[model samples]
Target: MALWGGRFSETPADAVFALSRSVHFDWRLAPYDLRSSLAHLAVLQSSGLLEDSVAEPIRGALNELISEVAAGRFVANETDEDVHSALERGLTEKLGAIGGSLRAGRSRNDQVATDLRLYAIDHMIEVAQQILALQSALIAKASEYGDAPAPGFTHLQHAQPVLFGHEIAKHVQGFSRDLDRIHDWLDRALVSPLGSGALAGSSLPLSPEVTAKNLGFTSSAANSIDGVSDRDFVAEALFTLSMVGIHLSRIGEEWCIWATTEFGWAKVADAYSTGSSIMPQKKNPDMAELARGKAGRLVGNLTGVLTMLKGLPFAYNRDLQEDKEPLFDSIDTVLLVLPAVTGMVATTDFDREKMALAAPLGFSLATEIADYLVQAKVPFAHAHEAAGKCVAMCEASGRQLHQLTDEEFASIHPSLKGDVRDVLTVHGALESRTTVGGTSPSSFKQQIKESTAITAAYSKEFTDKAKAFSEMMGA
Candidate 1:
């Protein structure tokens, strides 16, 4: 019989019970369940509703359960519908009815909410750590190659020359912003929901504050009706995961394009690539492809969770159970995807020679040409027109502007100097862009240092969060 079978005269049919079962999908949440229950029980004792005689044995049983599971000695029976029942079954088998006394004033409504928060907070630490690793990989790679010249793009067409490392660091900066969002989302996951029994506040005089403190929550909800029914935290988690996937997907897509023989901009390490059976020389970026595809899946899962919570009424509803699977799935996907992409990045090779050769083409220095005229006291619009004519003359003659003779350059614009060719040189073009965030070697070095420090600070913050969780879990 199910733990809640006392009100029913007969058991549910196989299909019915099977349909209602979540143990198959949610068994991974066992650690989270035990963590939340320990805090809840601690609060129960603090509130004077439970004596030490009962709470102590329950605490011992819970710890034993955690230890057994950690050592791979625990298993769930077919009859268990969820982690809650699996845990109660395990405790009863070992501690008898005394183990059952822990459920006196709570309902699965609040119990599941507690589990969700625990799961998010726990996984947030993991995801943040993974993000930091990827950032470090990118930073190391940047330090190695940030000064190598590459072309900047506009509408996917080369528009200007930039340092390759600076381009990669731009993406890392986006990730830094995203990691901040994940931390902000952590706030939602750190609110205790244990004492909000079912939909209403428990009448057991439960100490929500004690539970929150034990669980590492900043505080508990004041309105019980809002507490258990709220899956806003799940939505925020999904939203955060969606943003994470978006960043990963964008970078993955670029990696796939770059690794192609056509682009020849980067080469994936053999350890992170796959070969085709039919094509003898086809080494494909399967990891990048999967990362891109998983981004879409995470987005879809986020939408699914949001849709499920869209119309649910207050307190607790059957719909709340729908929240668990998506949260677990999204967290699992990001956890798997983040580490794989990070590994790929750490091992990939950049084709600096290919990038520099391509960087000087596609009129990448045209802006420099216009700016040169502007610096020579030419009117801005007149400067733009003169540069356009210079490019047109070069194209007609099947030559680059830098290859033009001084006499030919003079025909396009009298302001053109004999030194214009040198001005159009790749090194000159890069060094000329002295703006703070531009792709100059000197400026790019500054960005690398600043971004590396940002990642370091984030690493420290993540370590602190994990340490707090560890202390709270007493692990």
Candidate 2:
């Protein structure tokens, strides 16, 4: 019989039982469920709802069940409705009548809520660690390539020359914001929802604070209905992971472009690349392609959960059962992909000569020409027009900006002196923008230093939290 089947005239149909079962996906939460049970049992004993002797046996049985599950000796059976039901059966089988007291002041509604929060907290730390690893790889690459010139593009056309490190720093800064979002979300997600019962407060004088502290939560939920009903934390976590996927996709797209023969700016390492079956010479960036493709699935998971929650009324509902898979998938996909992506990045070989060769193509020095006119005290609008004329003149003559004769420059604008040739070189153009956050070599080196420090701080934060959680779980 089902756990809640006392009022039913008959057992659920086989199809209904199979369809309603969540053990396949939620068995991952079995440990978390058992942990919540232990904490709730303590709350019950402290409130005098259960004898200390009864609670002790129940606790001992739960500890044994935890060991069994961890060692693969215990698992949910065919009749088990969910992880909670499966573990309840295990506890009952171990302690008989004493196990029945463990459920006195709790319901599956609040229980599952608490379990999911614990799952989120644990995985959030893991995902943050993976992100930090990726960042470390990026920083290592930037350090290796220090100020190597590359064409910076706008709208798929070469717009200016920039250090390759500058481009890597942009992604690093984006991931820094992602880390901030995870930490901020954890602040709200760490609250415990135990003792909320089945969408209402229990009459047994249960102390939510005791359960919250026992389970490592910073606080307890203030409202019973919201405690059981709210899945905003799951949605937020998925959104955060979606943003991570999107950032990774952007990096993948760039790697794909850079590895193409036409660009020839970088090569994916042999270990991370694959070759075609028919074409013997094709070195395919399969890792980057897959990272790009999986981003869509991550995004889809976010929308799937959001759509699942949009029309539901407040308080617990059966539809909430749909939440776990998408959350699980998002976490799994990110954890699996990030390490591979990190390897792909860390092992890449950049062709500095090729990047430098392409850096100043397509009249990329036009901006520097305009800035030269501005430095000569020409009106800003006139300087821009004069620079446009220089590009037009170069296009007409099949010559680059630096190749134009002084006579030809003089014809375009009076400020176009021979000194204009100085700024036309790629290195000169890159160095002229000396303001903070520019692509100059000095600016890029400073950025790499700052990014390294920030990454170290985040690494420490994640490590400290992981240790604290481990200590709490052991306690």
- Which candidate tops lDDT? 2
lDDT (10s digit) by residue, model 2, range 284-376: 998999889999999999999999999899789999999999999999999999999999999999999988998999898998888888888
Question: What TM-score does each of the candidates earn?
Answer: 0.95, 0.98
Off by over 4 Å in 1: 407-414
Backbone clashes in model 1: 0
- Candidate 2 regions exceeding 4 Å error are none
Q: Weakest 10 consecutive residues, lDDT, candidate 2?
A: 466-475
True lDDT of residue 362, candidate 1 = 90
- Cα lDDT of model 2 overall? 0.90
